[model samples]
Target chain A: MILEPHQIELIGYAAAFLTTFAFVPQAIVSWRTRDLSGVSLGMYSLFTFGVGLWLIYGLIIEKWPLILANAITFALALSILVLKLRYPRK
Target chain B: MILEPHQIELIGYAAAFLTTFAFVPQAIVSWRTRDLSGVSLGMYSLFTFGVGLWLIYGLIIEKWPLILANAITFALALSILVLKLRYPRK
Candidate 1:
């Protein structure tokens, strides 16, 4: 089925805005607790790498929606990844 | 610049693998903490919604990369969103 242009644009906007701050809640909690005990550093490390790949895919596709969502998510994922590495389980 | 089909496939694989488990680390942490205190439900709520929109976008575009990434992400996001709501902070 075909989608209207506006509908597609709306998805793009939603994709951009939503994924941007997706990591905030976790970042804040991880920051506040300063505890990485329960947090999976290994998983996040790989996960962040995975996001990196997605960002590249987005770039390759040149789809604004994909690019925008991954770009924001990549940053957030990277930040959280740093924190996870910096502070391992106590 | 134009991209080869192989390059694009590589990206699709990467996107799928990366985002699929990207949420695992965070999910495990939240599960362990059971503390929604530091986590932001508002942000996650919107964030999940955002991912949902992206999934729609992905489906609409029929870009395997977009569809794969968002579908996995949507599931993870939804899981986290549920946890955030069910287990609100003290």
Candidate 2:
């Protein structure tokens, strides 16, 4: 059975909002504290690359849900990855 | 245009494997080092819940890409979250 249009949109929106907020706190804290001592650069690099690939997959499929979630996640992961490399908190 | 069957499977597999490996290092390091002094619990909690929701969404839609990536992510995130709470490395 086909889902209602609004229902699909709602799910997409919920996923987008949650995925975005998921990284916001970390982003804010990392930015504010400027501490990368505990963060791992290697893992964040892989994390960022993985999320970027996910975004590419979403784009190829033209799936909005996947696209939105991966896009936001990619950005956040990249931010963390950059901080990890640049700051390298001890 | 529809993607080739193998192509689709390859993308899914790639996404899943990458996402899974993405967290393996962190888990291993966290497990061995037991040093989460740099990890943020509040952010990890949100990240875990968000990935869990994505897994739910994947389950409902029967999307292997989302399911595999999110399942691995949720498991890893949960481990990190638990470690964060239980250990709270300083």
Candidate 3:
């Protein structure tokens, strides 16, 4: 069965929202507690860069789901990365 | 200028790898440290479910990028979730 374009777009949007919003609580807690010892700097660094690339890819393809999701994700990842850097887990 | 399908696929694969692999270090650290106090269970639950949905979406679209990325990401997320449940943060 062929799905409508709008339906496909909706699925993409839903997916984007779920994946992007999932990072919210973690970012908040990390910021509030400033306890990133459990968090990995390498992971956040790679994640941020990756998300940035996804955003670029989205832009190249002109897909709203990819663009919007990666935009928000990139910002969140950056915040986590900044926190990780500020509070080194030595 | 129109790009080849392979080139676009390459971009998708690259994006998927960066985002998916980003979790590797975090998963490893969380597993080794067993200190998830900083990790928000809500976040991981939402994330895992979201990734599962992404996998389903990938399957529906018959896109290898989403399929492979979400599959790997789902496993990693599951590992984190299990750890979160097995060792709750009090």
Best by TM-score: 3
TM-score of chain B of each: 0.75, 0.78, 0.83
Fnat for each predicted structure, in order: 0.63, 0.44, 0.63
Error of 3 at A8 (Å): 5.6
Q: Which stretches of candidate 1 lie above 4 Å from their native place?
A: A1-3, A32-38, A59-69, B1-4, B32-39, B59-69
Could you tell me every candidate's TM-score relative to the true structure? Answer: 0.71, 0.79, 0.87
iRMS per model in Å: 3.1, 2.4, 1.5
Worst 10 residues of 3 chain B by lDDT: B7-16
Interface RMSD for candidate 3 relative to the native interface: 1.5
Query: Candidate 2, after superposition: displacement of residue B46 in Å?
Result: 1.2
DockQ values, each candidate: 0.51, 0.50, 0.65
The TM-score-based order of candidates, best leading, equals 3, 2, 1
lDDT of 1 by residue, A1-90 (tens): 677999898777867776677677767777777755555665678777877787778777677766776677778777767776887654
The digit string of per-residue lDDT tens for model 2 on B1-90 reads 788878976775676577667777888777777778778777888778777877877777788877877888889889988887877866
Q: Given candidate 1, what's the lDDT at residue A57?
A: 82
The model with the greater lDDT, 2 or 3, is 3
Q: How well does model 1 score by local distance difference test? A: 0.73
* lDDT scores in order: 0.73, 0.76, 0.85
Off by over 4 Å in 2: A1-13, B1-5, B62-68
